[model samples]
Target: MICLYIGTNTGSCGLITAQKDPVPLKSVEVELEVRDHVATVVSTLNYENKEDKPLEAVFVLPLPGDAAVCHFSAQIGQTQIVAEVKEKQKAREEYDDALSSGQQVCLLTESDESPDIFSLCVGSLPPGESASIRLEYVTELAVQADDGLRFCLPAVLNPRYQPQGSAGAGFQVTSVPASLEPYSLSFSARVSSPRPVSKVESNCSLDPLQYLNTDQTQATVKLAAGHKFDRDVELLIYYKDAHQPTAVVEAGQASAEPGSLMGDPVVMVSLYPEFPQSVMSSTASCGEFVFLMDRSGSMGFRIKRRSLQTCIHSAKDTLLLLLKSLPMGCYFNIYSFGSRYEHIFPKSVEYSRQTMEEALKKVKKMKADLGETEILEPLKHIYSQPCILNQPRQLFVLTRGWVKNDKEVIDLVKKNSSSHRCFSFGTGENTSYIFINKISKEGGGHAQFITATDKIQPKVMQSLQFALQPSVIDISVTWDLPKEVSVTVLTPPITSILQGQRSLIYAQLTGQSSEAAEGCVTLKYSLAGHPSENQLHFSLRPAEDTGLTVHMLAARTLIRSLEMEARDNKGERDEEMKKVVEELSIQSGVSSAFTAFIAVSKSSGEAIQGPLIPPPSDFWHISAALLGQAQNYHDIHVCNFLITATESELSVKDPLLQLVSLLEASGCWLLKPALASVLGKTSKEVANLKPASASSEVWATILALIWLHGFKMDAKDEWELLAMKAASWLRAHNATCVTECVEAGNALLGCRVTKDALGL
Candidate 1:
């Protein structure tokens, strides 16, 4: 267990009692079972008290933001106690009473400031006693850019940087390095999908995949020998038919009363909307683009274990891609923040040669020198500016996600969501998923995470493409069911819909229907003034093997919406919403911010003596260098910076990015040495080869398009939208001699590119 100290005057001091021997936590064993997009995880944590007196252990850990924790229990010797969910205050009172009476008790509750953080307390643990804790949760895997399902098991919980005047103002964290941690983790996963399972990939070492069925739909994998719990464990699962829409209906709990959230069958529907090609071919020409970068000292850490690049450096590269991808005639600005924030321009400026170059120069010199993570202030500054007329506003936030005021940040974005859209990027293993996910959801935009093994350019460019697409409006979902049956939608209203993005909807089927009854759901929306709809039909029969996972997830969805509604209301309405939330949380046996899980062992009645003190772990900011480990960290930082600096000096060693950089704000490449060099030709040679009827700029633009198609065909996902923008600019100019330019360019670049391929 980890001990934390808060408030000022602490001075980075250790516990007066000295650190205990043989740290209470010993090892953890986890098993994961995944069916389709849903995953169920069971974890067992073993602890031993080696001290002379009674010990109370407190462990704080991070979970996925959208996970639903369903079960918690502890075993002490031969006795086992299962916890039950109750109102937070009532559970706390019972725990305190049990501890005072000398009974063994345990309490688990979600943090008020961050839903992803959970704190567990074990009281009155006898000396030399060992306890095994079992926790179970279910979560839906996130869809990645490549259509893979992403599941992350968080193992790192860095200290959150709190603002000076905020609640818990002086909170300081002392942490034991992963190498010094006294616990071991054993992990394994079992996966089954409706479609054939193609493969599974992870950043950590793993044994060979073992197939459980000849159809290749069931498989299992486990961590390799001598695995360390140093960073987050992430798995990306791929299926052959990934884009197919599907639905699962789960039967409710039998013991629960009818008409309750847990008693009714729940159905989860997954949809992937496809837009028309004509609408998708045109990119928006104008928008106010704002980029917010995190420059805190923590950003200096490696993006992932054994990676020779820091979070700040990767972010800089992504920013360069984003800046170069902006459409002509757009407005833009750049903001970087730490304890204090600074902007490249006092106000947003129109996109042009001068403005883009100016922003890139400042971004090139930026580093992670700032002391702390303070994001709230700069966000406010960005929101305060008056938006340009006829230009939509789009905000891009890049951070490592280590701020205390996450709830406040999310609320602020929710309040101002009507004015603009937000695109968020989280850049590390320990990135706060809740903060990153919530901020983007509230602002009606998309969220992406970049880990050690994940590439930053493709993901960021995908989100930029979403931003440049025309916004969808008038979204609605309609259901067609038997007359005797009805549906109660549990999920919140759909806000922003992007083409090829996944959306999940949960609903309760209350009435009875025939065994072979079929239901249909249609999603309707407008894109670029064109009406569109997608329909999915499914059988109403409950799935055979799904146990209350769907119902529990549905309950979680309603509970979250109610919690947000409570915060948005006042007086009687707020209290009323909270009451509903608490009742539903207890009824569904799911953990929430307003409720907690508590258990007491009635067999033990001996009150522990003396004041229970938890052993402290070494914790200090990485910038402080208070411990001998600083030298190792410093060495890693220097090595990463040197390698990244060399790569940057070579212009990313990526000709695609270099070609993108040379394109003008008007989406045309000028006939110059830089442009010719990207095409592997001399400036004089490119000029002499230009068609007689085509201008120099026209020839350069055609060559650029041909090169992108000829050499970078494998990376069409990253450059497709930008290429569309360039094509739109050419068509708008009514450029002549298109066939001549294509022929000359293809021959000069040694390619057979046609005019039709350039969208001319």
Candidate 2:
């Protein structure tokens, strides 16, 4: 049975639930269309209720942090409902009323606090009835350091801990083995660009690309059907000509009023402004560089497939490079935070040979031992300190983006913007794009991802260069259009613009123009105390059948501005603001913080009666869930299962070795780093390999127990049989080694295993 695992038992991590009797969602499919640098995605979910009673299911999931949801629709048999936007509470009330009245109702809303989170509620499905839901959203793609347009589909949403007395956080469904979920996924994408498409790359497998044109600028690709939902689906699209400015105009939606924003023509302008090389080369040598490092548990997540190194090591290495590169006279400080924070010195100190050496010593020895990812309190302390005169303060924050109160953190940064220019570096399986972007934007800085090894040093060095470069100021965009045409700007006014950075501006065309017409826009800014301008001209002809992407994207930008304003005016959620937001959301067919999409199956007259039960999102944010392993981990080379072993040769007594016999049948481990050291060497060169010795028996039994406790699965009763035999053998022969081996394994792996849990 397909199970709809939702809110029945979630404390709030955004994972799916599996109850005794649950509604089943059968299939998930996503279609993505890319134009220039923006992408619009449509997702469809199918659910069937086999139970005799009615079912109400909740699907909680994560979207791209910058996504703007524009459409929601549902179909059940002959009945189909298109959703309309309303105030969040009003939408909920309408959904509850429709559900209680025996009607099929659905509601979709973005998380009030976390922009990356969203929830879809499908209510009151009658027994044996099936429903199919579809949602569409648009987001602008981010340009990577390598000049690739990066697009990621987040299938995993980890749990967030809400602070006490704060607005309650949404619950997340826990993840399980992907194969056990029994849901299938299909994904397809189409690409169109002005520049020639070089290639498409991803960590996941994909079908061969098919080009519709000879130039290779237009193409389509699909994910291989057997793909597992184990990690963020990432796509890096490269263009032949890396840097160029372009403008695109799209036709309006036909169904809307001719003069309205939805129906009027729209234009999207992207510029990669060039700065004078002679002036940009004159970078400053004096500034205060404060480094905040993440020592949280998540930082231990390994980015390299086979290396023993984790993200923390890379972060530390980055810190070393940054510290060494700092100017001699500049002041610097290092603060590492998890639950609480600490500083390398009592206050900011000069970058001298002595201090640099001391800091390097501490940086090399730092470990990811902090309890949780708490960064707010440390930031407050940092902001409280005074900035040195004539030397501006530059904050370099490296974090895993695990904190729950993102709004609070954002507010703190905005408040401290005047004193410090913040540069953010995010690290994780999937970097926290929302938090890092907001932090950099509000603080007049730049945000970069340090997730991969290839871009780590270059991105850090580039950001450092930007930090040291004279700041660009007095930035503005001016448009010169046809005399009779009037333009309604959708994006907020330009505040901060950087050199070599690509930025997008969206606007609507209200009045008609001559058949053969063109318009121009100029970007004016002052750099290195000199005024500069860059201009572009493009035809005013509207591209046909562009859907409502640009208009909805415009609405989303407006909604975000309103939300940020509201953050500063907390407890002042007046009726006028609510009215304005609701109107915009409704007119654009988009969802906002205080707005949601609700629909009811009008053809169904009676509501189904049953207990109210909700579940999690259709997809997951797969951090490291066990799924799609073709071979038993225990039998494979230890390095292949988890950490790759190259430098350290593993010994048989290595506590992690106890894992070999333990999971030989089940999938979880191979052994340890020590094992990998001898992986390729001749057997004679390795130690402790014999038929059966007294030490071997004890060590095998103990190591097997450690594996069961550290990485055991619920099913696989046969593995449990092996475990029982190991325990019996230990009890009869060497029970004393049990506790010792467990402690040794836990110490090496940085985990906690209790005696009781180990069945001692």
- Candidate with best lDDT: 1
Candidate 2's TM-score: 0.77
Worst 10 residues of 2 by lDDT: 630-639
What C-alpha lDDT do the candidate models reach, one value each?
Answer: 0.81, 0.69
lDDT of 1 by residue, 1-760 (tens): 2244321233232211225343578899999999999999999999887777666766666787788999999998777999999988888888877877888899888877667777778887787889999999999888877778888888755567778898665553434334456789999999999888999999899999999999999999999999888778899999998989898988778898767778878899999999999998767879999999999877877777676677887788788889888987899999999989999999999999889998998998899877688999999999999989989999999998888888788889988998999999998767877788888888989889898534666788889988998888999999999998789999999998987888899999887888899999999999999999999999999999888999888988888888888877751338777889899999999888789999999976567665543211111221133332322222222322223433454335667878877877677888989888888899898988898888777888889999998888888887776787778778988887888888888888899877888788
**lDDT (C-alpha) at residue 255 in model 1:** 95
Residue-wise C-alpha lDDT for candidate 2, range 1-760, written one tens digit per residue = 1222323123212223334443377888999998878899999998887776666676666788788988899997668999988777878777777877878788887876587888778777777888899988999988765678888887656545343445543222233323445677888999998777888887678998888999989999999878876566788888887678888787777788888878888888888888888887555758888999988766766654343556686687667557755654788999998767889998899877678778877886787767466788889999888888877899999976756788888888988887878888876455577888888878878887765654565567667766777767888989999998888888877766666778788888888897689999899999878898999998999766576677788878887777767656765665677677777778887778788888877655555554443322222322112122312212111222134322132223333222331222112223333332323323233223322333544544444455456655432221343344345445655445556656654554345867666556
- Structural RMSD, model 2: 16.7
